[model samples]
Target: MTIAEGCILVACLLPIACAWIAKSKGFGKPRRDGGFDNHSPRQWLASLQGWQARANAAQLNSFETLPIFIAGVLVAEHQQASQPLLDALAMAFVAARAGYIGAYLADWANTRSILWTLGLACCIAMFFIG
Candidate 1:
């Protein structure tokens, strides 16, 4: 597979890392009695505080971003675009996504949004290069 294709696999792993960190926060502990009942895992996660909550949000965001990234890679590949350029853009997407996770967890809303925009731009630019 091309580097762009490989980036999709790396993209898939990003959310798992976020979730692992979030889940670790409450492992083997009862859910704090928040508004939601602990009967469901979703409810339990909703009770996560501070960085854990941000991590969960980042995890969700990663899933939201993946399909667009996958589509971009597919388009670039299908169009027989410059392999080196596509690979560089794909790598940039991965790096931006990693930065997004950090920014989100750190509660840096402006940085997170900027990273999100950057990732989207990278994905969209791949289509144009094709």
Candidate 2:
């Protein structure tokens, strides 16, 4: 894989790391029935409805965006895209995702959305530019 692809892979893995951290911190638990107990903050966040769902919304939103971005990078590379620009966008996407995760965990609503939007925009730009 190219550097840009590696960067996207890192971005993709961050939330899994966050989920692991959440699980380790008792935010979610593994049930004896060979399934996860979706009962902690993670589940609460995931099941968020109405006005209480923003953080979970943001988390899911980021999850949704990263893959498309990675796919775009892959397509671009296969089609002989501009490597420098793709690399830059990949790095920016990762940075924005990290910011989004941090801000969401901190419950900083405006900042989290801003970061999420930035990442999304980066991905969108890649789709077009790549």
Task: Tell me the whole-model lDDT of each prediction, alpha carbons only.
Answer: 0.89, 0.70
Q: Give the TM-score of candidate 2.
A: 0.72
How much does candidate 1 score in TM-score?
Answer: 0.90
The CA root-mean-square deviation of candidate 1, after full C-alpha superposition on the true structure, stands at 2.6
Model 2 bad stretches (over 4 Å):
27-59
Q: Pairs clashing in candidate 2?
A: none
lDDT score, candidate 1? 0.89
lDDT for residue 59 in candidate 2, whole number 0-100: 48
Tens-place lDDT per residue, model 2, 69-99, is 8787877777777889888888888898888
